[model samples]
Target: MNRLVTVAEMTLRELVRRRGVLLLLLLMPLTFWLIRRDSHVGQSVRALLLGISWAVSTAALFATSAARELEPRLRLAGYRPHHLYLGRMLGLWALGLAVSVPFFLLTVFDANNLRYAGIAVAMLCCVAVAAPLGMLIGALLPREMEGTLLLLTVVAVQMLLDPTSSAAKLMPFWSSREIASWAVDHTDDGYLSRGVLHAAVVTALMLVTVAGLFGVRLRRRRHLRHAPLV
Candidate 1:
């Protein structure tokens, strides 16, 4: 418990110190809100919230602290890797939620509808979907540049083949049709059902991806540990 708490504190503080994370979490959302102020009220707010959530999750995964120092420092302090990873994941999720809530509230108030709750759920769904994807990318390509390029490629593909695109309809998270339909509906029934479905799918995918990444990391660590020393 103490180790997890320490890792969480350290992760949070490290996040605070990163200017890029700060800008992405704060300034970018504010800018989006200002720029889209004149647009359709509900849709604009939904888009802004989605963008902010996506950006924050992506940034958190990529903006890691110096891990080389981390292993030695933690070892010297007698901290376990599992504790550190758990704490870091907790901190990341907390930060993601912090950035998400304000935009959600803005959407709820501006839209002034119970359906806005669906929008909030959808945004969180997207974040859940994106975060593990980010972690998978991080694990596969540990180098920052490689991971970043991979992320950009994926983002590019997603943008080019959004839900409206025929190719994207097959993608789990990209199919925004249900959400879009519910967005047009004033009733909460379709909205809640579709939103919950999306959230469930995303949550499941995230869990699976996290498990895969953990397995890969564990295997690689074991291989390295057993390697003949020079």
Candidate 2:
């Protein structure tokens, strides 16, 4: 437990130190929110949620990429795979929440007649799903640029695709859109239920995938087997 907490703390500190990255991440969502502010409240809120997910996931991707070299060393120092990934994930989730709070408050003050609770839930879902998704991408793609391009492609699809289409359901941030519909459009309870379920399932799958990847990649190999004493 202490080890996990230590890794998480280190992750938080490391990310916080990247002042430029933090500023950009914070700006992305605010930009999204501002773009649609005058057009439609629901669109603005939905875009805001997507921006939050993108920002957090991007952070997670960069964090995981940055730690790729250090993680093996940490493993040598007795850190388990779960400790490494889960701890970093916890930190990213915390960061994601911090990024969401300002936007949440923005909605509160700028948009009237919203189900604020649903917006909060959507933000939680975004943070929960995004962290592992980013880590998974970071693990698979050795180059940060490649992983970033893929992440951008996914987010672009999520934004441009029709939410009602079957293909849109596969997108990681779909739950946020669904719940945003419930919150903004005053849709039925079914939307909320589906959104929550989708978020839970996606988060579980991504975490498992990331764990497997990290385990294989970080496993210590017998590259130099010791011989019997001469």
Candidate 3:
């Protein structure tokens, strides 16, 4: 537990130190919100949620990529795979929440007649789905450029695809769009329930996949020899 917390803290510190990246992270969603603001309330809100998901996922991708070499050393130092991945995920989730707060406030002040609770839930779903999705991509593709391209492709497809289509339902951030509909359109309770269920299932699957990938990657490698820890 202590080790997990330590990793989480270290992850947070590392991200926070990247001032330029943090600025870009904040700006991306704000730009997304501003782009759709005057068009329609639903579009604006949904865009904001997507932006948050994209930002968190991109951050997770880069974070995982940055830690690739260091993680092996940490494993050699007795850190388990769960400690690394889970701790980093916790930190990313915390960062996602922080990024969402300002935008959530923007919605509250700028938009009217919204089911604000539903918006909050939708953002939670975004953060929940994004962290592990990004990590999984980063794990599978060692190159940052490749992982980023894949992330962009996923987000782009999520945006262009029709929400009512069956294929759209397969997209990871679809839950955010569904709950955004509930929040902004006042559609129905069904939307909220479905969104929550989808987010829960996706998060579970992605976390399990990430755990397996990290476990394999972090296992003691035969090529290097080092003194056993005392």
lDDT of 1 at 64: 42
Task: Count clashes in each candidate, considering only residues at least 3 apart in sequence or on different chains.
Answer: 0, 0, 0
* TM-scores of all candidate predictions against the true structure: 0.72, 0.96, 0.96
Candidate 2 residue lDDT tens string, 82-197: 99999999999988988889889999999999999999999999999999999999999989999999999999999999999999999999999999999999999999999999
Which stretch of 10 consecutive residues in model 3 shows the poorest summed lDDT?
218-227
Model 3 has an lDDT value of 0.94
For residue 131, what is the lDDT in candidate 1? 57
When superposed on Cα atoms, how far off is each prediction in RMSD? Answer: 4.6, 2.0, 2.0
Task: Indicate whether candidate 2 or candidate 3 has the larger TM-score.
Answer: 2
Clashes of 3: 0
Q: Can you write out model 1's per-residue Cα lDDT over 136-159, one digit (the tens) per residue? A: 566566686777676666655654
User: Distance from true position, residue 159, model 3, in Å?
Assistant: 0.3
lDDT of 3 by residue, 1-230 (tens): 99999998898899999999999999998999999988999998988999999999999999999999999899878999999999999999988899899989999999999999999999999999999999999999999999999999999999999999999999999999999999999998999999999999999999999999998888778887988899
